[model samples]
Target: MRRGYWLILVATILLVTGYHLRFQAPATITAEQGTANLGNWDFTHQGPVSLSGDWLFFPGQLHTPASFLQTLQTTGGAGRAPQTLPVPATWNKLYRHQSSHPLAQGRGYGTYALKLTGTGHSSLGLVQQPACTSSRSYFFPASAPSSQPVSTLGHVAATAPQSLPHQQPVFSALRTRPGAPHYLLVQVANFDHRLGGLCRAVYLGTQQQLFDLQLQRLIGQGLTIAIIFSMTIYAFAIYFYTPHNRSSLWLGLWALCATLYFWTRANFWEQAFGTGGTFGFAFHYTVEYCSLLLMGPFIIYFHHHAYRTRYVAERLLRGNFAAVLLLCLAVLVTPVEWFTRYYTPLMWLMLAQLLLAGYILLRALHDRQKNAVRLGISALPLFFTIPVDLFANLNGKPSGSYTELAMVFFVFMQGLVQGRRLGLVIVRSQHLSDSLAEEVKHQTASLEEKNYELLIARTALEEANRDLKALSITDGLTGAYNRLYFDRQFLIEWQRARRERCPLSLVLVDIDHFKALNDNHGHLAGDQGLKAIVSHLHAIFRRASDVVCRYGGEEFVVLLPNTSPDQAAAAAEELRALVASTPLHYHDQEIYYTVSIGVGGLPAPGPSQQPLDLLSAADRALYQVKRDGRNGVGVADVIAADIRA
Candidate 1:
């Protein structure tokens, strides 16, 4: 009845209020280049709302990062004439950049306006398309490949008259063939961000459904492969991250020995593995390989950093980065075979690093915080979540059992554990408070008669109240804060950040296809998986200031204080990969589960400034991660992007 209860009630009310506010308003976005004219588009964000209309997109020209950046930099800000560019064609060969190595100018820059009110045919084509060499397409980030060749003409003209009831902002398109038949149909309220382009779909007669099905199939395939990759990685992670945390270079290397997945993801991968190659090879050589190499040391350092083993970890990181960078540069100019030779040590280095991380954690348990011990104890059950069928999957064993009863059981258990974690926190808190009160009452000289008894009662009540206050938001299953707690905490943090003019970050963790796991395994195994995760996360995240909480259902949230989006992303990625690498098993089934994370952060200066925007941004980023294929992290900032509409 004192200020305590009032404060708690007020806090709870405020949080609930904020939850609804989140869905109240849309984030304003600014118009940019192609987006400057779109009429039928939606504003679902707070930053730049470029031309994401019912229009056509002159997909990017293929250029090296340098040239691409130059174009962006030159035309990015305001008050600049649009560059003269061949709509969808690259300047790679035209500019004689074949020998430019990693610095080739292959990007497209420019915008064209158009309008589509009815289902009419209109052709927006390109001139002088790049030659489609199978090798070239494999390694590069291709926005759109030329489906067919276009004829180049001296000039092109817009024959259709622009007519509409209102002067509406339309959309942009790429280079059009001087003469070609093109038609587009724009539908109202059917705005989609699926690759956000004007003339997003080709109206090929009544066969539109076929294209849609094909597109969906392609996406489905990518997703299928990604899920497999994630599962494999997750299984390996848990297996590698045993309670011992000792070096397992041999095992880790064995797991990662295949380049098939990596190659499949990159354009250059096809160059090396594909029948004919080297067209899309430059980007892979310079950027992609270097990126992997850079990650090697970090992986090693994280795994082995805790080890008493000193110089090897640091040296590995430095050397790996340097080696990869050099290799990347050489890849730009050198052939695949020559590059592969230098890349050999990279494999050894990666294996070494993974081993180091394992050892460091184990040793840290032995000589240091021993938190590793707690994590191990807590994580043992997760070791059981490994699907029984995992061995066959790894060994390329002909999926001996499609219907894995053991795997199903484990997933079921994980769900139960997750549910219990969510539901029992309050019951546990109450129990703890009651027990504490009883103990204190008995210990205290209650009823020194009446006066003493009254004081004792007051004390018991006070202690119980405090305990309940703590229990309200904490998750019973994983000791992390519950969604209720996380939301309240986020609001409070947002208020603080606003008042103090500081940064706040949110990491949203989603166990990949957890629903499938639940469907396969029983509820109990799912619960166990959740519990293991809560325990493991607690150990990895030792910072007292950080907040690890359960955010509704299977999603977990981590809030970092005074951290940027990138930092939050790095932290999330590390945790994700670590979770993936940790070997969790159950019964005969041994399969892995991965996570897709989204990070969002912003500067908040007051309570009046809502926390919903940040949550929305983070959610958008998370959505992007999932859409792009789960098992990764995406940090999106509408503000940094100057998004407005």
Candidate 2:
């Protein structure tokens, strides 16, 4: 997939570059010794032609068309003739030996003159793009005696203050008359830039052709600006939504800088705001310099955020940011001439940043970081174009809009890389989602099985706990609740009865002559008799709230909630009769047992009445029953008074 994308990107770049080259104006005619003879040339058929050959140069002099014509007519083009220098070149590139006139050293006044000889009268248009620091051109017809120029761009003068620099594209129209030689003169002055004179080519064509060409260039520039600006918006949106990815922020900033810088280059500001005064010029240059200076830092920052790097790249990034910030400040405050002088150093700084970017990218690739290869591939065009543009600027050559095209290409490649990343993320997410669903289904079945096992274990544990509790509270021999159970349950019953204002009853039963029986019939007989008595007692007093406990050896007690003392005594008598009737058959002999019963109750227990008082009253009644006669029942009311006694 990656290789295919790379091939497509390479093919697209090649096709676009070829298309651009194919449309570029070709120079077919060359002038020698300040004259271009196009007697047989057809302007309509060949399209616009670049006036690229040698033109007569007069150094240290700014001349009008009339004065220059006068000088040529009087001098007869003999001694003291103007030295010939190539057009579409800066004065700094002039060789000392090539001209008898003193060189401007890229900072002086000069006049350029060209003579043209064409066949018939035709309407001609001169399209001058951004070429020099300041210049004015004139076209004079030799057929008329008047030396007045038919077209002019700006008020070009020898002094710096009088010269009005027109940086925007200029289109001047003129009509050629038959049987006349035409003169084209341009006066140029440079005091604010590193390289001066005509630095860009001038094209001459039919009026309609020139307008169409200018329109094409403007449309191209507008489209480039719009595309880059859209990328800026996209990057900013990403950054705003996901703040953790700082690369998006830096990319947005870099794209914004590129947009502004290119807008300035396309001279959109002059068109929008009109040809400005001193403040306007200063503002324009300041924005241009600041935008250009920030581009390097922003891109470096973007790279640093896009990939992790060693300390070297981080330090370089910070240093580049600080340097660019300072340069931007200088551009804001300083004059155009002062800041423009450092253009070379600024270019060098940008070059260093590009190298740093390459280093970081290579390291990322070596470490096998994500998107490293994509990013490196996308950066190729920018890397190639920037250095070429820098070289052209340094050598004072016209470095057209190749950098802009390269930037657009780079952005397109980056978009593709980002799109691929998003697609992979979506695919991986879908796979993971499916896997997660399957895992959840399997885990849910396993959990249900484990829960069923746990339910069974819990049921068994509950049964065992109930059995243990029963054993803890029950007497082994009599199968009745033990004294410990009675001690705890009596208080709870008393409290509940007191709160509900109900009667609480206790019945005490003692087996008569138990020791005598044990002595006569042995301990086995005694145990069997006790069990028989307890069974009869439970059968007689069988209520949900009734409690039966073996108080001690041969003694049993029964507690009944919501029962009166009389009712409890009746129940106790019934239990005694039942005990007498029921006997245990041990060793084929029947063992009979009789129990003396006592009843104690509180119809409405007082606040001061304690649970132990009822037990004491019951004990007293039991003693009374034993003293009177065995197997009989007795009752004791006033439990609290008895406890006090």
Give stretches of model 2 more than 4 Å off. Answer: 1-19, 26-28, 95-103, 119-121, 145-151, 309-313, 422-645
- Candidate 1 regions exceeding 4 Å error are 1-465, 603-609, 638-645
Residue range 352-451, candidate 1, lDDT tens digits = 5545555555566666542345333432332332232333322212122122222222222222332333335546655766675655454343246677
How do all models score by TM-score? 0.28, 0.63
What C-alpha lDDT do the candidate models reach, one value each? 0.45, 0.76
Output the lDDT of residue 82, model 1: 43
lDDT of 2 at 352: 86
Q: Please give the distance, in angstroms, between residue 364's alpha carbon in candidate 1 and its true position after superposition.
A: 68
